[model samples]
Target: MPTPGFPPSTLDAGGGPIWISELASDDPNHAVHVVRDLEPADALEALGAKPRLFRPCELPRSKPDKWTSLPAAALGIEPGEVPPG
Candidate 1:
């Protein structure tokens, strides 16, 4: 029987802590796990009426839209190319 509201168990895998519940349902054959501290009740409650649901392929490829404009070296720009005071 599958456990409801309970994430999968990832014990003794030598990786990090993982939540089984967050695993995508599409791949039942593969085990699901999540890093520790990734989930918190307070964080979920912050979502209020718009709680996000995780899907197999719905994993985020990048940061949220609001943060896209922020200056980030990873996007590009050599050290000297940046404006200096």
Candidate 2:
């Protein structure tokens, strides 16, 4: 937890809430969430989501070798490797 004496950083309001969400890793459930908009973010959070690390560069989660090229959506985890939620 952050110390209560820590000062709150002020936000510059310019772009839409989308921009704030992007900077906050687009995941409101994260501990480091910086919320500029509450409506939409609240809806998504009510649905239950884990705080996931965001990759702004859209890179795949795993390193690919000489013979294999993987899609970004695969998340570096094999299809059958993870059980259904």
Q: What TM-score, computed on C-alpha atoms, does each candidate reach? A: 0.19, 0.22
Error of 2 at 49 (Å): 1.6
Write candidate 1's Cα lDDT for 1-85 as tens digits: 3333333355224333333322322234563323335464444445442344421123333333532311223343343464232
Best by lDDT: 2
Candidate 1 local lDDT, residue 68: 33
lDDT of 2 by residue, 1-85 (tens): 4333323442334333433434354334444344434654464465565335332245343335533223323355454465233
Give candidate 2's whole-model lDDT: 0.40
lDDT of 1: 0.35
Error of 2 at 32 (Å): 24
Off by over 4 Å in 2: 1-43, 52-74, 83-85
Candidate 1: TM-score? 0.19
